[model samples]
Target: MTLDVDEIERLYAYPATERPWVRTNFVSTLDGAATGTDGRSGTLGGDTDTRVFALLRSLSDVIVVGAGTARDEAYADYEVDTDLRGRLGLSPIPAMALISRRLDIPQHLLVADNLVVTTADADPARLATLRESVEVIAVGDGEIDWPDVLTIFADRGWTRVLCEGGPSLHGELVAHDLVDELCLTIAPILAAGGAPRISHGAHTVDQQMRLAHAIEADGGLLTRWVRDRDR
Candidate 1:
């Protein structure tokens, strides 16, 4: 049951709030693996997930992604549909916010709206080079202070935040109480490899989530889970 653009928007509209509303979107296999054998999450999703993926990007001002995942998933493509964003009245392209501790980003992606979110613990020489090409955001001296990052995003009017995770980053966001929702698509594949789950970190917090809705489409289960604000 593939949905048209309007229905997709109706299903996953960002909450109307002043602060940053964080939502991490991912597609996983039935076996709980977030990727297929080829080491890419894209292989686990189908047409419906692709459509929703586009809508998620079309609705956000910036895409927060781990530098590793950005490289593994070829996010240098920016994965944005500019025309779709235009018709939906969103920014022509969501800024690609690549978080890297070492400041190891591809040279070609070091232009335009590619924001390098890192820390003071990174390599100084590399940071100098990256700063020359794009804006560099360092919110933490030892680690990434996600709360401050959110504040910066809000200050820039990029309140609708979409986190495309490589697990650790998503886990940090969850542990920080910064995530508002998770839009997960369960692909019907039993990937029995060692791919990590959707979110993991050195530390974790147990926050209750409400299963907002689940829709079956394109041989996958599209689910929306919102953080239970009362919890």
Candidate 2:
């Protein structure tokens, strides 16, 4: 059954919390492949997933992504939907934050008004060029200290953080215990080709998650998992 706008909003809505909520949204195939032959998650999602993706973006205050995903996905500057912003009482279009130590971001993305959350040892020359268009924040020496990144986001009042992953970033978030919820869409497609799973990294931590809800549409399954804080 196709979900209406109101129903979709109700399904993905977050409750009033004392602190910022961090959520990660991803799409995968039935075979546990996070990508397809094209090496992008976009190929795995269906029409229903698209609606959910847009809704997640509209509801978020900031969109956090790994630099690799940002480059591979060819991210564009987020456009402000004034009508939705007014209705939601949001300040502006959600800001995009790219995390990278290389500072090797898409050229057009750098020109757009965004934030580069990088480390201190990032290439100075590349950062100099990016600085012309984007704001740069140095949080670590080589690897990004996830905790510091969360603190920075919270300090800026960007509490509703939405992470669109390339896996490694999601792994880091999971390892640091920064992920509060996960919205995963299981595409109906059965991908036999080799691909990474939703979360990939050397740093692994066993954390239990509770299924908050699950919905079916267009033969695909959209599921939300909230961290079992008691675990």
Candidate 3:
């Protein structure tokens, strides 16, 4: 089920619902390693997976990531393609949102376009420094209140949220039952290294999801699963 660029975009379009939609995008090996032996998910993504990933970012209004993933991936300010944005009727640029408890964001990503979602009890000095320029969002005291955070985004018209995770954050989202869709790309190779799974939250919540689409392309399986609203 190989699809061209346009068909891929159409296939992954955000649901036209008023409520906030949290769509997570991740790539894993055939044997279920989130990252390859190189300790990076980028290494496992094939051409089709890469195309779908970029399209997901471009189509969404915001790019959400944890601080570790941002730092590890060396995430910079998100520069979305204007041509793609216009075609998809998306905003000019997808905002970058970093979720961190310590506010340990990189200097390059401290611009106004980037947001730091940190805990309310974060260091005053760090908060003060970020307050001078960036949009600082405080969720909880020690743990993040992801539902509240999503509600805030919904109010801000950032209903189309794209989360590129670092496992822990994805785990938390799953634990809280906040994930609306999961786009998993299964790479062809088998990576048996000590890489973590796609998610790792302490508390577990078993939820059912419906597979919306599955496509085979670029030596990988690109699949989308929509969260089942009914239990």
Top-TM-score candidate index: 3
**Candidate 3, superposed: residue stretches over 4 Å from native:** none
* lDDT at position 172, candidate 1: 81
Instruction: Please write out the lDDT profile of model 2 over residues 54-123, one tens digit for every residue.
Output: 8888887788899889888778765544676568786667888888878888877775557999887888
lDDT of 1 by residue, 120-196 (tens): 67788888888888999987888898888888999988888999998988888887887899999999888887989
Ranking by TM-score: 3, 1, 2
* RMSD each, Å: 1.9, 1.9, 1.6
- State the displacement of the C-alpha of residue 103, model 3, in Å, after optimal TM-score superposition: 1.3
Model 2: CA > 4 A from native = 79-81
Q: Compared to the true structure, candidate 1 yields what TM-score?
A: 0.94
The estimated TM-scores of all candidates read 0.94, 0.93, 0.95
Worst 10 residues of 2 by lDDT: 77-86
In order, candidate lDDTs are 0.87, 0.83, 0.87
Ordered from best to worst lDDT, the candidate numbers read 3, 1, 2
lDDT of 3 by residue, 1-231 (tens): 667878987899898878788999999888889987667899898888877888898889889999999988887654556898887677798888999987888888889888889888889999999989899989787987787888888888898999999899999999888899999998898877688999997887888989998888887789999997832
